[model samples]
Target: MNDPDGGTAAMALGAAESGALDRDAADPGHRDRFLIPPARGGRYSDSAYLAGNSLGLQPVATRNRLLEDLGEWARLGVEGHHDALRPWLPYHALLTEPAARLVGALPRETVVMNSLTVNLHLLMVSFYRPRGTRTRILIEDTAFPSDSYAVRSQAVFHGLDPDSTVLRARSADEVRDVLAARGENIALVLLGGVNYLTGELLDISAITAAGHAAGAVVGWDLAHAAGNVPLRLHDWEVDFAAWCSYKYLNAGPGAVAGAFVHERHLGGAGPPRLEGWWSTEEQTRFEMAPVSRPPASADAWQVSNPPILAMSPVLTSLRLFDDIGMDVLRARGMRLSGYLYELLEGIGADVLTPADPPRRGSQVSIRVGTGAAALCSRLSGEFGVVADAREPDVLRMAPTALYSTHHDCWRAAAALAALLPEVS
Candidate 1:
């Protein structure tokens, strides 16, 4: 079978016993750079950690990286801005090149900035302009709640009714149809690059073209898409995008996030946005002039000086991405998740995520009958598996390419099979 990222699959692991797992282990070399907790036996081993969709495991390099930054801060004090290792003045640039590689954007179009929601609001301030009759906003009905809230609040800020002005589409085809009919009235089209609940990967390039054809600006909330899959944000001609670093990027919890604005939007005629001293030219930033002269890059979206300590872990994780590259990781994710899907199919549970290889990421969200959350609890406590439960019935399990193995997928599937009679 062809891999979703445009390569032929070398081999796909259909079951845990398949030697494909052994082959993948040597090539990508899993479970070494990461530090997974030992299962109760006092020996280090990978537990069934299937929750990268919610929070990723820590990279071992993060500790030394943080200590280095702290030591520099203690040694140099105020002088660290220019004198210490990784000079504080230009620290954010350290993450820019690797991050650009991960998202398929040029360095000039991307910036490591505030958290995901903050960047979303900041981008909307510049792009969500509702003039005269084009005052509506479009989002997926299954979008993460924070995205929906931000779009609704933007509509309200523009004096439009949240109920009527914020429209919801159920699928990609629906987006194209609506844009043909009502897109002339749309101020913005913002949707999740991957659905958080169902693990659906949307057709971003197609949607962006449709939105532009109808004269509406398009943006993507890529919190679930950024590092899980390969993205061509610039080649897709995306107007703007924002994503968090805590999930597949494997930065620490609530780590700093990132934003991207096309080169076309960074020029003098670009849309107006809220600015800070950091958005100005570095040579002139300390001048403290009253007027704003924002640079012609995505860095102009920065609202304040970055919190350096919070950004340290991002460097540690992004460096690993630079080493392994997105192509290998995405291919491994397909095999790992495909193994889990085969196991789950034999167990008779309803899998909500798309079965098509190209239409989904590494996650497999299962729909249990009655006690889904409690089943997840049992899977964690008794079976030593860690998967997340979303509300009533969905259990999201992600077999991350960085740390998880085919054995972990088998263990999780066996645990679910054992608990199914009680859950059903």
Candidate 2:
């Protein structure tokens, strides 16, 4: 249900056009850099694009790659698998370097594979070995439904009761308390690098240390954090992690996802992996022997072959990230988003995400009061500002760096201010 008062009816566009703050104007030429929907009908349509943190706009390069791949298919026939310029034989491997660079890890430590939820389960299968007293798994209470479901199912698969094995933390104090109280019994810690709904970036390094102190393996779900924030997964000593490329990475819908296993956790020197042909030894990969020799690295975790169509989009997207660069992109994101935060703060909207610039990533979540969902609906329906709403009170807005701009942020802030009077 929307707010009974409908606060944004007149104020939506009014607040957006109300003399945007000076900082909202990024440098002249670059100002229109990622203007995707290009200004249609006079005003601004990039404002309709604040939802990249949810699903990114399709890059023009992505479309071109798709066409190129389709052409290869039409001309090369069945032999295309080996005859094509980008051979399907080692397609997944091609993504290793760029993907590893994106998340800050050694190439062998990362592999573009399965969906986020599936990879989480596979990583758990290898890492979540429960011993006598150390059988619990620590997870966030507000984790995405997919993560929560995978954790619980893994617990059941281990012959442990989910009720007893699932330990949860809500607030910072609660998190500290759970780790202290049950640290000795935790077998694995599965946390999101950045939460899906709240957009809270977790301290993976600190949490990993705490979990390890208790003799537990620590893994993170970076579905929302992977491309949106700077991550040093290898440096942080993470045992394992997984993320979808569709969100911040802006791969197409349901695009191939990626996972990481610290170099220390690969092959015989590593934890027990659930294997498949893709992770088979390259030397004897086509020998079709009765016995299987696992790949030397994290590739050992794969249980099946990869889908090439799904990976092409990911390849194009990462190239763009490399071209634009994550460091430069992230810095602008913080500054531009910080301005958005002030604009919302100025209107008395309660910011739920951390205010500290370093702690937060690309997203800024807000609690716009009792009628938050309704106001959000109106923002999309009436104003064409494509932000998303979270349950009872929160609205999540992220100005992605690769495609989003300063003017987009200003427009969104102005839209919110316009709706203030109607709700109040």
TM-score of each: 0.93, 0.91
Candidate 1's residue-wise lDDT over 1-424, tens digit each? 1112111111122244455357455645457899885553212254678998889989999999999999999999999999879888889999899989999999989999899999999999999999998989999988899999999998888888999999999988898889999988988999999899999899999999999999999999998898899999999999999999999999989999999999889878799899887888777888899887787889889878888898899999999999988999999898888878877775666898999978999899988877778888888777778899987888999989898887788677767766665656
List all candidate RMSDs to the true structure.
Answer: 5.4, 3.3
Best lDDT among the predictions, by candidate number: 1
TM-score, candidate 1, is 0.93
lDDT of 2 by residue, 34-54 (tens): 436543322545445777777
Which pairs of residues clash in candidate 1, taking residues 3 or more apart in a chain or in different chains?
none
Show how many residue pairs clash in every candidate, following the order shown: 0, 6
Q: Model 1, residue 191: displacement in angstroms?
A: 0.8
> Which run of 10 residues does model 2 get worst, by summed lDDT?
26-35
- What is the RMSD, in Å, between candidate 2 and the native fold over all Cα? 3.3
